[model samples]
Each structure stands twice: as structure tokens, then as C-alpha cells.
Target chain A: MTNENAITVKNLTKTFGDFTAVDAISFEVGKGEVFGFLGANGAGKTTAMKMLIGISKPTKGEANVAGFDVRTQAEDIKKSIGYMSQRFSLYNDLTIKENIVFFGGIYGLKKSVIKAKSKNLIDELGLHDEADKLVGSLPLGWKQKVSFSVALLHDPKIIFLDEPTGGVDPITRRQFWEMIYREANNGKTIFVTTHYMDEAEYCDRVSIMVAGKIEALDTPKNLKEKYKVDSMNKVFLKLARNIE
Target chain B: MSISIKNISKSYGKVKALTDISFDIKQGELFGLIGPDGAGKTTLFRILTTLLFPDKGEATVADYDIIKDYKDIRSHAGYMPGRFSLYQDLTVAENLTFFATIFGTTIEENYDLIKDIYMQIEPFKNRRAGKLSGGMKQKLALSCALIHKPKVLFLDEPTTGVDPVSRKEFWEMLKRLQKKDITILVSTPYMDEAELCDRIALITDGEILQVDTPQAIMQAFPKTIYKVRTSETYRLIKDLKTYPKTHSAYPFGEYLHFTSTDENLDPEELIHFLEQKKHTQIEVEKIDASIEDTFMELTHTREVNAHD
Candidate 1:
């Protein structure tokens, strides 16, 4: 079962001082599954993602991401996964192409390969005009698109995107999802976290966290059925209402 | 009108934030200003709240002109900017006390008004506002905004970056606040939140695209929309775009929301077409248009119009 599972978890937990940030949570994700990690602010989504990504050590339990043990094989896990975090993850001062090149280089991409990939990406996104422009000068939507492209540069097995569509308009959000769907179609597993319920519906499976615990995990359609709700928003509300 | 905007326009030197924006809000109604980033929502909000001046036209809040009676408007208006703006060094209780004191009131006097929201964060009243969680900070900010019991409340993207559970809770709080007979104007980029308002005005690139109840807006959609899916969704959009009858094709959650110019189209026809294209697991079902669909339709036309 573990061999086929893209990600396998059992009793993953994390704590900070007196607070149990991420309670014991277990789940299995298939290859190419767009697994959504959703929760209210302070609901332990970040803590749990960190553990799975191998940046933060777990307080207890066992979990594997991309067939690498999060505890003992952190380096292997790091090399096999891509990340597009919300903050301090991208260089605003660098040009669009430089940012891509830097990310590719850090992933150990060869210089010649980085140059070739940068050219191809610039052409693909039709950003040849802004190749030398500072990423900070670009619009929010454009910045997100470029950052997403950078995340895919290394072609990691699983990509972790934290609120990639936040603050962008509906059109841009849809375009971003299209990119995600394209990746998933190519058998790349996508792990995304977002606050928008409508975006949750796009995920193949979604996990709702509440008070440091996984309160619900099912296909968006099934979760709606289980909660007797028509939308993911109401399902989240139902789960959160039970919390203190 | 509880609020009125007549041909209001604003510019920041070379950039036009809002252009000839006009709308009206009835008394005690929850109105939404919907747009994406750089769509001039914040500029419009600033002008309506009397914090910034418009280059042309006029607006009124609580029947007080934005320019002539700005003092009156200021006294009766409560604003929560998209960005959290509170004395970060101050504790939750301290910030509430400071805001209330500046409004010539006391926390005890307005405790009942903000009690529901405050009680949720009261446990951490001693923590610095900067150290509070995102949802808690937003709730506290709302409490501060309401301490003065303003007749009008303006919240700019209050739920942005907040989680779904917290977003639901926040909207519920707004519903409860509406019971006080206060007219509310809230702006957000998320289209789903637009449906919660009594009425919404969809804005894009500094212009009002449409204004109506969410239900009415959905019904106003001119085309029959269908949610279609096939084995290879990556190619679904491209393939549909090439179909001679395809009017519009866009990827939604698990399916593509498609429309065809052909009249009385059957799902079988679409499935048969896709199967012929060597696609498997074809599923096509007619679905009602969502607010987002309407928004995209409205904005999509403008994209073409801009070319002309």
C-alpha cells in the first residue's frame, strides 16, 4: 500500500511549548492527486505541511513524502519536492529570469540547462518582454505565474503551493488552476492550501483542519454529502462550529 | 440613499484607479464592491469613506456629502482597511480601549456592541496585537472599527488571507452586525463572498461591470452553460476551443464550464464529439451559472472591448 501511495502518514504530530500545533493526522494521497490542505488560521495546516516537507521535525509518529521518510531522509525529501511558499520564498529584487535561474541553480540544475530552461519558460509564459524586468514590478497575478513556473523548473515529484491564488482575481485564479491541472495530468502530485471554498472544490481530495486536528477528509463532493451541505464553505463551517 | 456615488473618478498622477464609478446603496443594506487587485476597489473605498478625494463627481455617506460634510461622515463611518492597522504594540484590550477613548467613549459603554467578537479573542486580551493570529487580528480589528457604533461600516477585503472557517465566521458576524441597522460596504476579491451581500457591484479596471442581486446576476447569464469533463482535462480546454460551436471554454474545479452557440445542444453530442477525439471518461452536465461565471462573462467582454 505504501509503495503505491505518493504520501503515507500515520499519527503525524507537532507541538510548540504548551500548544499542540498539529495533532495526530493520517492520510494517503495517490499519485497525481491534487490534495488540498485547508484550515482556518492557526488550525495547524502550516505546521503539518512543514513536517511533511521535512523542514520541521515531528514531535511524534511516522510519515513519508515521495517515498522518503520525513524523519531520517529529510535531504532526499527536499531534493524530490518543489515548494512555492507565501513569504521569503522568491526574490523580489531579481529580474524575472534571474529568479528562475536562481531557483534552478539551487535545485542543482546545470548552468547550461538553467539558461536553456529559462529561455524556454520565458517563451512559454510569453514573458520575453519582462525577462529583464524586476519581479516586483510585475502585477500580483503575473508574479504568481512566474513563481509557479519557477517551482516547476526542477520538475519535482510533488509541488507544495501555499495560497498560490490568494488575492488574485477569479480569471487569474482559474488560469493558475489550469496550470495545476496540466501538471496533474502529467502525473505530478499537487499539494495546495487555500482559504477559498470554491478553490477547495477543485481539489481531488480535501482535508479540513480544526484546532490542530484533521476534522474531515474526503472528496469535496463526499464531504458535502457527509455534512449535508451544498458547498465546501458550509462543510468547513459545520466542522469549525464544533470547536471552542 | 444611504450612500451615493455620481460619476466619481480618481487618479494617482499617471494611473487611473477609478473611472466614472457611480452606484447607490440603500439604507441598512449590505453592499459589496467586488473586483480583483489593481481594479481600483481600494481607491474607490478610500474616496467613499472620505479618506481620499476624487478628482470629479461627488458622493454622500449617511446623506452627508463626502466633501462638504466630511466631518459628519467621519463621525458616522467605521472603516477596516484591507491591511490591518492597529497599534500593534497595544494589547487587544488596550487597543479597544484606545479606539473607544478616541471616539469619546469607553470600552464598557460599547462592550455590548463588540462583545460577541471581542469575547472570542478576550482570552488573549493581554497579548500584543502584532502577536495575535491572523483571524484573531481581523476580528479584533472589526471590534475596534465597531467601538464607535458608526452608522456606516466599510470593510475592505476583510476576509482576504483568512481561512474558510474564519471567513464563514466573519461573514456571520457581519450578518449579526447588520441587525444593528448599519449600512455596510465591503469589498473583496473572492467572488463567492459577493453572494453574501444584499447586492453587489462588480468592478474591473476602474469601472462598474454590473450591479444586482447575486441570484439576478446568475439568471442574467445569456447562455446555457455546461460542465464538461473528459479523461485528459489538459487537452479539454484546447479541444473545446477548436470546436466550431464552442462559444466559451474554461476549466473549473473538476470540469470545464462550456457554452455552445448551437441551440438545444445535447450532452450526448458533446460526449460523442469528445469520444471521437479519442478522449475517455466523458461526462457533460448542464449546470446553473455561478456568480463567478457571470463575472468572467462580464469582464471577458470588456477585454474584447478594450481591443476596439
Candidate 2:
């Protein structure tokens, strides 16, 4: 069932002992939309993301990701979504081809499909020459691109990118965004997070979390207008001004 | 000069980390080494901080030779590495005290020096360093680095991955530190932060690309950039790249920054071409080059030069 909303959350929350990491929050992400999830560090964005991605249990509330309940169908949710983070994505010691095959197998793809997808990915990324080279030897930008491709190996309908282009060069950052746009155009719902406010403006909608609560949620244009700021950076600064 | 480097180079086996790096920081000047990951910023910082040695050439920090007087530099310089190096199990106040004792000084001795920054996190002084938020951790790290009141401060990517609000505050603290006659050498990946420094050196791929004030560097961009926007962003980038006269096209927030190979480029002609391609809501405006634009251009030129 391909519902209009790829993700629906109502009062989703997570707590640790006496500390409420993610307070009661609610939101929905539509299909084929780019949703920017932004917040200050330790603002509970990570805690909330963990619950939605099917790794951690929520302390309270309800969320459905890709038509699967987060609490009951976490395995199905994991199968329906692709995730790529800058810190942990691919094995550096493995060759590019090997990493591709390994990830494809993890995603339960067949051997023949893994072989064919690996070829197409290498050719598309122009990494044919480096396919046999250790992933650790590749440049940071190239590695990031390769990691993102591997995340999409199983062709998930929704993708989650956690700072995929962090600390990358300017040109490479733009190139990564271009890849994001191509995927979104292909009808994949993109849920991404980034410290770079420029990337925020590219999303169809954005939600800013502050102190374990969603402080603002709207399109970038509307958020800018509401905050009376010319840029998302200014809006963020304005909202996070009172943070401890 | 607070810090002087002459043709310093370093290689990690086959990989060259720094090549012919030369720069000098004035006393009390806030100097920035701006670059992305894999740049030689950290390598140079390590050399200056006396944590690592350069294979060729020499450097001096606070009038002490990096090689001959490495021990003296250790006491005279305060370095905050990119990675958080403080003991996570220790409380915020304990970490500060620990660093102060190591430097043969006390936090009470330099209370006036770090009052502004230290006070911001003093409320959580009893919290474990591991339990602090990202911003709080950074403040504790900085306070510990400054507990000795060293003559020179070297911060490597201090604001990397920090939110905009905290990053701005951190730079403001740096501006105040510069006024206290403490020479500040900071490195960052954010190009916008480069403008906050009195002078900046743009390094990439282990080589310095340009060294100048942010204003001067932007002035020498050598291209007329136009902010172009339309409905289909992805298509616009592809079509613009395929254009014969296009020099560069990259995303700049809500617009695609376009530059032409020819000096006398006409925006009207570009608009007409996009209209033919069925792009609606077309807007094209001439804009000044930003530090990011200049960086990409310089890196691209370096690649082209390498090809030759």
C-alpha cells in the first residue's frame, strides 16, 4: 500500500531515566518529498531518528515509517528505508565492488542482482578504475558518493541521509545534492539532516528541533518569512539563540 | 611574528600531507587556515603545536623553534585539536583543573582571561564531560585549553559540526581573545568563517591555494557570477553544464550560481535559452563571488593545471 504519506508520527518521544530526550512531537512526511530534519546537537534529533529508523524503541508515542508501525514492524521499516551516515556506512578495508556486494547481500538481494547493480553503480559513478581498489584509498568525496549508492542498493522507497556531505568540498557537496535531487525525482522520499543551512533551503519542508521539542515546522520559504530572516542560517541562529 | 613557517613540508609515506607550506601570523592577529577534509590544515597545526614534526623546513611559535625548543612551545601554546581530547569521565571543572596543573598554572590564575567563555558553562561544572552537550563540550575544551593563558592559541576546526548559533558565539569569543594580545590561529571548513579572521589561507589537497584577507580573495575571483534559478533545479544544472560558454555551475542555496567562460556574458541570452527549454519562473541576477565560489574555482584551476 503506497499511501500519500511515507511517514506519519504523532506524539513520538524518547526518554532516558529522568531526562526526556525527545518530548512529545508529531509530524508527517509525504511521498516523494524532501524533508529536512534540523536541530542543534543534543537537541534530541538523533534520539528521535533512532526510533524512526527501527534501531531504538521509543519511550512513548506512535510512528509509522513506510507503512510499517515503528514499534511493531521495525524490521519491515528497516527493509523499506535506506540509510547513510558520514561516520558509519561502508567498510574502508573492503574494495568498492566488495562493499557493494556485501551491502546488497545484507539487504537480501540475489547474487545476480548484486552483480548487475554493482556494475551499473560503478559505471554511473565513473569508478570503474577504482572498483577493485580498497575503499579506504578513495577520496572522502568519492567514498561518500559510494556509500550513498550502496545505501540505495535494495531500491528502498524512502532514504535517510545523516550529514552525507559533512566536511566535503564545495563542488562535491553540490554534486551530492544533485544526486539527492535525482533520487527524489525518481519518487524516493528523502529524509535528511545537515548542519549546512543551505541544504535546508533545498528541502520541500523542514522541521527544526529545539531542546527535545519541535520548535518550528514548515517549508523553508515560509519558515524564513515567519522568522523574518533572509536565510535559513539566520532563522536557525534566531531560534537556537536561547539554547543552553 | 607570533608564528613563522618557511616551506614546511611533510609526507606520510607515499601520501604528501603538506607541500611547500609557508605562512606567517602577526602578533595578536586572528589568522585562519580554511579548507575541507584531507587538506593540510591539521598537519600544519600539528607542526605548529609541536605535536608533529615537519619532514622539511622549519617553524617557530612564540619566538621558540618548533624543533629545538619544542618543550618551550608546549608551555607557551594552547592547542585544541579537531577531536575532543579531554578526559570524558572527568567533570567539566576537573578537566580544566587538570590542564591547568599540567601547564604549571591554576584556573584561578587565569580567571580573568577565560571569564567570558568559562562562565557560560560554569552552571554545569559538576556534570561529567561525557554527559555535556556538544556545545557545552566545546566550551569545556576551550576553557581547559586557555586555563594556562598561553601566548598563542591554535584551534583546529573548533566549530566543525556546531550549530550556527554556537559557531557564531565561538567566533565572537575568538574576537575577544585576539584583543588580549593572544595570537590566534584557527582552522575551519566553513568558508563563511574565513571572513571573520583578519587573514586566511585557503588550502586544499595539501597545498595552499590562496592567502589573503577575505575581501581581497573575493575581489580576485576573476569571474562574473550570475545567480540563476528556475523550477527544475536538477535539469537547470545539467543544461547549464552542457552549455558551451559555461565556465562553472554549482548550487548556492536556492539558486544555481552560473559563470561563463566569456567576460561579456549576457543574462538575457541565458534566459532565452532556458525559456526554450520550458523552464518557468526564471530569474537571473549578477552577484558578487563568495569565498566558496573562489575556492571551487581555484581548486578547479589546480586540477586543470595538473592535467597539463
Best by lDDT: 2
| lDDT per residue as tens, model 2, A33-133 | 99999998888888899999999999899999999999999999999999999999899999999999899989999999999999999999999899999
Estimate candidate 2's alpha-carbon lDDT, on a 0 to 1 scale.
Answer: 0.92
Task: Give the alpha carbon lDDT tens digit for every residue of B106-215 in model 2.
Answer: 89999999999999999999999998988898998998888898899999999998988889989999999999999999999898899999999999988999889999
Quote model 1's TM-score.
0.93
Candidate 1 wrongly placed segments (more than 4 Å): A1-3, B230-232, B263-268, B279-281
TM-score of each: 0.93, 0.98
Measured by DockQ, the strongest candidate is 2
lDDT of 2 at B226: 95
